[model samples]
Target: MRRRFSLLALFAIATLPLLVVLAQTSDAPTCEIVAPDLGSYIGDWCAIWIRVDDPQGPQTVENVTLTVTTSPPKSKSFVYTTSRYNDTFFYANLSLPYGRLELTATAVDDSGLQGSHTIWVIHPFPVPYFNSFDTPTIHFFESWGEDLTNWTISPAGTWHVNYSNYHSPPSCFYTGPFSGPITITLVSPPINLTNWTGEAFLSFWSKINQTPSFTIPPTDYCCVEVSTDGRTWYLLSPYIVGYWSWSFFGRYSLTKYVGRIIYLRFKLVASSSGGGAGWWLDDIIVGNEKKVLVLDKLVKHFSCDSLDEWTYSGDWSVCTSTYHSYPSCICCGSFSGNKRYTITSPRISIPSVNDGQDIYLRLWWKFLIDQDCRVVVQLYYDGLWHSIGEFRSSLKRWRSSSFWITQTSGKRIKIRFMVEGYSNYASFQGLWFDDVTILVFNRRIATKGNITGWFSTENSLWRVTPIRCYSYNFSLWWGDTSTCLCYYGVSYPLDLWVDLRDVDHAYIHFHAYWNFTDPQSCASLRVCYDESEWVLLDTFMGARSSWTTRQYRINGGCVVRIRFQVEVYSSYAIGFFVDDFAVLPTTSDTASPNVSIVEPKSGAWFNFTNVTCVWQGEDDVGVCEYEVRVDGSSVAVELPPTTTNY
Candidate 1:
């Protein structure tokens, strides 16, 4: 009884302190833009203003920052201190480029709570930019507005991009629920008319057919305005309410803003106390010269045609009820675990004679997969299926992709699109295909950019994610290690392999940056002789959360593939980063093979019709094949180099 009482007393003592602790609740800091009138612009060298507050108290706010972003240019960040806040605003002065920009304001409290907001604004663009509505974000459509889309920007044309109407086809900018009153403005690409070269004019097509509103003050209105500094605007076209038809509004002179950088504004409003179809504009051309607007070049490989030529083994059919696109698309929604569903194409055979041009298959597709599920594009040749490429990421937008058929340039083949599941997951996923186009070219056009070292993370859990990185934070490798759920005693290695192809000696160098909270992880190096089976060379599981330079030497041959395998038992932290993984081939085999016969000893052979003969061959890189010509007749020309008596 004394021993039991003592153990109980110790247990109570161990947890007694935890019961009396007071934990302070942390609230995310509130962040709001106070200056530059967010979603617009300020001076190129002026400061940005923001207002930050914390629910706990102002003292809880630790850091406030603003990130000015422009694609193709490195983003810049500015810090905000409490000293910069003058009771009403937090000022962050920065020198930013003129044009369309995105400002992201973030606030962090002392307890790591954060709040952030991002808004797009106009800076300016050099004049003469053009837009034909084919590619909305192209340089010609340099507006930081969400009102532009190649397709419908919003749904059902509720002041959004819709399929109902386009100056071209398939896309346009629209503005309004019209259920109430709304005002939307779209800015044009930057134009620096500081150098007046020739005649400068604005050209576009506009359409509006509202059945007038009951509000007499301003029923529905659209006007063209010009801004020299992106903030102060001067009306160029009077507010034309109840503007009708798809009329060409053109030849408006923009020579007045010749001494400064400028941006054209399209301001639209609808006071639809009673409403109708909203306003739309397309084919915007602004410059020192006028250009004709033409139809958008459509490049659809297979126009939503019949599916009679395609064959599928699972539940795949044409779907039309969806709102997105591809009025006719091959969709596969039904799934079975540990099974592969494929959609096979009819025979895609080249001419009997071998042509030298490379074969490419380009298509538009979208897919979403659960754990261990993937979509693989394959080609069937010589009675086998070859996986040329695979997609593992869960993509929401439609993707256009092209893959080269490696080494099958002159062969007759058929293409296969398949989806595979590795486990019995209950989550729902979908795979859809819009069109497939086959093209032949003298050279391959595309290359994989995210190849870590010489290895590809296709069809593996190891991939490049923005979660964590050692450098270039966006597309760095995370090497997420996974374990197989269906197979016991097996782990799904975060793996990437490269073909060494007959080289037996090489050195691998890479950088490892780890952020692990007592992780039970393994960084295993392996080699694959054949395409499938892998052999472990070594494993590394040192201390976690540090940057280390890793170098490994490998000795393997003949279709050799190097792999970095990772298996995670459990994880608590961000990422195990793999950077600059590369291999250095050290094999220098330039000498000829040394061969010596070891049979028919000194003319004392047996009295047999066919005498058995043997020879030994050796090379620095190992012999690929043994060719033996019996009296110049090529009797045993094809033999394995590993065997001399076969």
Candidate 2:
């Protein structure tokens, strides 16, 4: 081979002169810590790799070396071998202790040109630990095997350990504001719950402070998440900072993952456009606790002679002697002017009841006022107070009153008593109440079928037609569908009826919406006890854009019929619409009246000539009439049918 120079010898000899000249004039070789960059958490045997490159040739590179300096004053060095031309690769299998390590790579060319790069790496311990950051000196590793003791702070300057903004004593971890788009997460060690039983809960306290402008788009969001494997996570709670306050996120039941190993992490994400005061967290806990639900019925009798279950606002007291029965009664009294005294009963619940069952409130009360004082009973229903009944005039002795709690079968309710005095001349004795009772019974009529008696004549000028959705802007009633008694393009009256044959003390309820263009346009709701005569129950005048509930209570009757009449004064007005029409039967009062002679004792003789007599009368529904008699001769004057006294 023409003096037989080997290939290796020929390559080295051909590049030797060129490599020496290039190394003297070229820049220093560049070095980069490609593997395990800054802020990386590694294990015991970490493979640290570095790449060194030179612009000259591979023969221009002299040596590549790696030096790892760890805490506790320990150091190690490794030399790398080049495997490719113009590029040198260096790697070391490092058994790093649980601490921070400073990795420096240096590359020196044959001409004495050198380049160096330095990075930081962390070796963290394994999990199942807690950290409060209370230690005086910040260390990369703790004597105990806790990963958070050697937690990696990314980019080196974003996180801080301080005593401010902590819920508990000592210190907490805080993330300061940064320049632009950043995501910081504080992760907890693995919590092994594989052998635990029952229910488990995770709870923590956190506070966030941010700019308090509503117009700005929210750029900061914080949440807690849990992971089974470290790669995937499920969010627990996500919140944006609306105000600066300390909030305790109490136990969130993690019963769904009772028997599995999990990890908890708090993540904070922020954007550069809007700045904030950052987030603070402390007192994190995970434990085994079960949550309970309450589902119990309410029952109160007031038989213990105590007002403990009631709340009163104004002049109220408990009296032991002057009551309906022996033990006690609630006494409200001595009111003047237009002053009112109110007492509210505790909240009571009625579980689901059958269709035809009835609920009643029974109580005994006595009032000593003359004319200007009244006692009104109200029931709280559907966020409003409805007056059930009232007691006026003088009742010198105890009387019983019963009210039907209709339309509230499966709800929670409260009963309120209001005593008001309109004048100063009323009696000072006030009102006395006792023996409050709530009872449920099956007293309603078993007939529960819909009335099949709606009549509309096509030849008539006024007819009932389905409401047109396009004409009224698609405004719907309670049932979203309705019928209107329309006399379109005319000014005539419309009539509609539904028959109720044997309904006893029934109520007719319907929803109505009307738009009257003219002032004289009106509608009248009526009921007929006899076929020829109609009794006006209610009348609607003027305009109503929204639906209004209308109800009428009819006395027990065999030939009852409900009718609606609408009259339009002008043709420009849109006719009325009615929906959800139903006849509901109420409980009938069958008990006789309770009468007592309170004044003028039975065997006592009268001394004066014009002795005014007083007596008490009460009934469940009402005391319709009262008749007075002396030795069965009807000597006393007759009182009105609505009178409760004589």
All models: lDDT? 0.56, 0.58
Task: Give the TM-score of each candidate.
Answer: 0.24, 0.24
Candidate 2 regions exceeding 4 Å error are 1-299, 423-428, 444-646
Clashes of each: 15, 0
lDDT of 1 by residue, 1-646 (tens): 9999999999999987776443333356778876677545344466677787888765677677777765221233334343356433567667665444567888877778788877765453221112111111101121112234222222333445556777655556676435446666766545655534334667667788565544556657778889887789898875667747777675577766665678787876666363556777765655433222212222224533456888888778886654223246778885757877888888865432234343446677767665567778888988898876655545454655655453564567787888888788623288877768765443211111233123322343445443333332223344433332222223435333333444556555555666434436555778765657887766656455555555555654543455555555554324356654555554665688776776767668576698877666765444434567767676434334223210
lDDT comparing candidate 2 with the true structure? 0.58
lDDT of 2 by residue, 1-646 (tens): 6556687789899999999878566577888888887956676588877787887666566776777664321233334443323456767766664445567878888768888899976553221111111111101101111113324445555566656556544555667654346677876655656545546667566677554434444466677888888779898765555444656674566678767877776777666654567777654656542321111222445652777888998888888877665457988867556677899998888556565554667677776664467778888978988776655544455655656564567788899998887776644458788988776653311111111122223332332222322121122221111243444433233232323334457666555677776777766777766557878888777778666655556765444545566665564556566654545554676777787776677888877877766666765444434577766677434333224311
lDDT value, candidate 1, whole model: 0.56
Those runs of model 1 whose alpha carbons end farther than 4 Å from true positions after fitting are: 1-301, 322-326, 351-356, 426-428, 443-646
